[model samples]
Target: MSAQFSLDNAQKDGNEPIWTVTQLNSRVGRLLEASFSRIWLRGEVSNFTQAASGHWYFSIKDERAAVRAVMFRGRAQAVGFVPRSGERFEFRVTVSLYEPRGDYQVQVDSMRRAGLGDLHEAFLRLKQKLEAEGLFDPERKRTPVQMPQRIGVVTSLAAAALRDVLTALQRRAPHVPVVVYPAPVQGADAPAALVEALQTAGQRAEVDTLLLVRGGGSLEDLWAFNDEALARAIAASPIPVICGVGHETDFTIADFVADLRAPTPTAAAELACRPRADCLQAVDAAFNALTLRQMRLLERASLRLDRARAGLVSPRQRLAQQAERLAALRQRLDQAAARSLERGVGRHATLAARLERCRPQVAQHQRRLTELGLSLQRTLEITLQQRRQKLAALTQMLEALGPNSVLERGYSLTRNAEGKIIKNGLDLKVGETLQIEFGRGSAQTQVLATHGLL
Candidate 1:
């Protein structure tokens, strides 16, 4: 007799020695397929090979666990991506049992640079979303000032990062004021806190610009900077925002969208300060340049004054020329006075004789009187005729041409369908339609006859 047997999912789980080879293989294969399909494993590559059929076979193992993975030719070709040996990555895998071989393995679907690795997966997802929206475009970023009068900082006041910024600003340029707004640098509430502090600094009239900063840590540690709201706020800030979120290699959305980005809080502080040394040097150079320029200007002005004095003309000579012109003008006047005396006397005699011969005043007066009489007579006749017989004649002509007058004269005025009076009888044929109007009534009629003028 067979002893009672039970099989678990493990190697000894089944009591199926009586089963056929093909049937056992099919059952085992299906079991392996369903088991492997849902696994996600992180591993280092080992014994990786690509067959001539374009299928990839590899073993994934670390210190603790080892698994066989097969990436089929179809899946392999679609990946367009190949991972080399010794590279550590997480792959989405599917397990399937091959019926013929009765073997089990995983199939890789797709992968990226381990996007979900210790980094904030959600943060990376948001980053890619905003990046595609072009918020991270370099063109949108404004250049930070080489020297700022007042540096505005939005960060936790209690954090060491704030003290580091203050120290660096003091070291570089102690004269410039530092405006600090307390903000939450990390956690669920950090994003809102950072945005408010940024807005506060921007709202202040005294603040020259902004520094959105936090100390370095894990990706999740500095996630406040990656907040979409904070990124958009920094981008829209009236003051330029210089982001100093974390270490050099660490990237955040704020770093990309800010007006400027620094690798650390201290670097951002150094960037914002207008150093005493640079200022002193610039002042000295300016003074020297100004002194040289002033000397040249003074010399040029002195030379101009000297040349003007040497070339100056005397007022007495100008007055003498005017006196000579007056003397010549007086002599010409005397000569003209003598000629006028002789010419005036002769002109007086000639005028006296001409006035007697021509009597122009009498002739002009008579011609005016004659013109007045003829104009009055013509106007009077025209006005009388227009008020009497001519007005009656125009009235009679209007009455005779009236449509009712012609219709009442025993002649019917025929019009076309458009109500336009027919002027020529030939305008309508016998079969064409016509509208005939008598004195009191109108009727539609067909053109029955045609006639021509003799």
Candidate 2:
């Protein structure tokens, strides 16, 4: 059907243009849609119905007026809860008119319980804020005590959560003592009371593990656990806290800040301590292992002892053995001494015979020495005569080559004042004193002139 339509197109008797019911309803619906975009409406639900096709048909009304609404399956599926009669809700819808019945209605895009939207928004805002502060950091979270000595519970005494926790602890860890710090789990004063209880448990420092627990409820009922002060208290607790608030699907700020989050109160108690039977079994196993190890060590020590006993000897017997060894050594020493003395005597006799054989003939040597002396004298006399003859010849040659001989041959040696013999006229300096040496004597003179010999 075309959205653009005009009553002027069809005329009746030219009196007045008229529109069909379909045309009128379509035009009115379009006008309503154009006038208002999607809007949020708050009213109590009435005459709610769900079709097989998963569409929701309902009526929303205040005290004086009511409006019919329909939500398609796609949008209805996104809504978390079913709409019930008499329940207030906020709907995001478009105003429209049904063409078939010409009835006015709203096409709902989404819906939620009236007040829950605000609560959810607050929850999200707090979650985001705390997450920004690292309260939800996994690294900062502590591991719950595996075997707590004592467990503390922070819950109202009359609460079902307290009963569940106590029952669980009794079943899993009866040996572990449980201390309950009474506090209100819900109501306006619950947050403060819960904070006080947690702070008290922390101050006492009596328990290694603490359980912050509450039964499942609506968001408003569980809002106490979402308080900022309560979350900060849980984070500041020295003891490891296991927060069990509401059901598994329910989450509060306490759960994020706690050291551990349990899906239920019973789970928190179970996680706080180990089972007593399991602990006993572990202890027994360790004892058995230690006993077996000790037995093995003892057996090894026994074997060593037995060996030592077998090798042990009495002091007297040990001394007798030492004496026998000494006797044998003494006999061996005596034999060695006797053999050494005999060898020494034999060596001495052999050396004495060698000395006799090597003895010098001193008397014969003395006679030989006298003979050698006479021979040496004769040789000395011959050598002296030869030396004397050679000496006389050398003397004659020397006398022939001597300056005195030259002087006797009518030659003279001239010497300068420095007593240096002048062999040539070039050696004579004018006006220099000279000494003339002849065979008979040396005379001092002065030279006035010099001449060169060719």
Candidate 3:
């Protein structure tokens, strides 16, 4: 006989179950994935491990329960920071069952550090929203009353922060009056109560300044002060607000929107009220400063007056000195003028004497000139007679030495046909032409024969 067995999500093949453990786990994974598509879970990390494959395996747990989780390498790379043991974190994940061990686990998609969780994220979002709207602008923050006559406080009456602010104001400024507007300082309703208290104090307008005070706590505990509506109300308040929420290290939206932010509740009160003794001391210092400045100015003026007095001179004395100098100059001028006139007179007399001595003797010069002319005439006549006698003697001598004169004395002159004188008979050639001249006439002849003069 054949028996049929039943199994979950198993297909029957001819009365035999065909589903493997792996197939079962895969179907369960698909169902879980479809049931919870993406889920956010917040818990602390434990038993964390990073495999050589770069995949992360860890367990996330709250105080009571824990779940196994795995982040693949590709998704883990985008997580921005590494997951560590014992760190509180939040993640969005999908559920799946590992087929090998039938273990249920989650596949993490993304994660973040959960130091303050959603409250911190909400706080940042609201802060950024208000900042973009210019609510946190430094220029819009009003200056608080340095010395307020009446101080308004917004806080829980049961809170220790209220007592602290009152004690500080009493110690610093006992004369200043205190008005309290009580409100819850935590939980969901706290933000609206705080905003209403701010409105009430602003409407009254009796308080010179308003103080928003609260004690220090974690980000979640102080989140009420980070409310968006409360921040706007504080910014719109007619009186300037001093915010003293949380500790020195803590900050909230109210602190940023308030005109002044103190480190503590007592500090906020002290800031609004100045001590009487300190005020008196400041007034005294100002008065002393003014008096000192006035004295310095007066001393400078007195020194100027003294300097002017020392530089003073009498007008009459100056005029008398100028007159004496003028008289001396006039005496020198008179001496120079007299000396110039005497020199002029001497020069005129000298020029006149020289003119008289320079007169010309015209008659004597003419007689002497006439005597020189007669002597020159006599000497010229005598020289001319002597020259004539000498010239006649030279003419006679010249005539006596003439060749015609020699020819006239019974001598003859002979010449060749070329007119050359024939000095010797040898100079004539036979049958050559010659000419002979007596003192009175001349004849041509032929050298028919030669004769010796010897």
Clashes of each: 6, 0, 0
Candidate 2 wrongly placed segments (more than 4 Å): 1-40, 43-88, 91-115, 318-454
Candidate 3 Cα RMSD after full superposition onto the native fold (Å): 25.2
Query: Which of the predicted structures, 2 or 3, would earn the higher TM-score when compared with the native?
Result: 2
Question: Which ranking of candidates, highest TM-score first?
Answer: 2, 1, 3
**TM-score of model 2 vs. true structure:** 0.50
How far off is residue 92 in model 3, in Å?
16
Q: Candidate 2's C-alpha lDDT?
A: 0.89
Best by lDDT: 2
Model 3 C-alpha lDDT per residue in residues 148-208, reported as the tens digit of each score: 8799999999999999999988888888899999999998899999999999998999899
RMSD of each: 15.7, 20.2, 25.2
Where does candidate 3 have its weakest 10-residue lDDT segment? 1-10
Model 1, range 1-454, lDDT digits (tens) per residue?
1234333432554544455566667766666656566577787666779999998888777667777888878877876667665556777887666667766567777544553332355666888988898888888877767677787888998888899999988888888888888988988899998888888777775677688778887655776787899988888788888888888888888988888889998888877756779988998999999999999999999999999999887899879988999999999999999999999999999999999988668888999999999999999999998799988998899999997898788878778888898998877788788888898898988877899888
- Find the 10 residues in a row with the least total lDDT in model 1: 1-10
Pairs that collide, model 2: none
Cα lDDT computed for each candidate against the true fold: 0.80, 0.89, 0.88
Q: Give the C-alpha miss distance for residue 52 in model 2, angstroms.
A: 36
Between prediction 1 and prediction 3, which has the larger TM-score?
Answer: 1
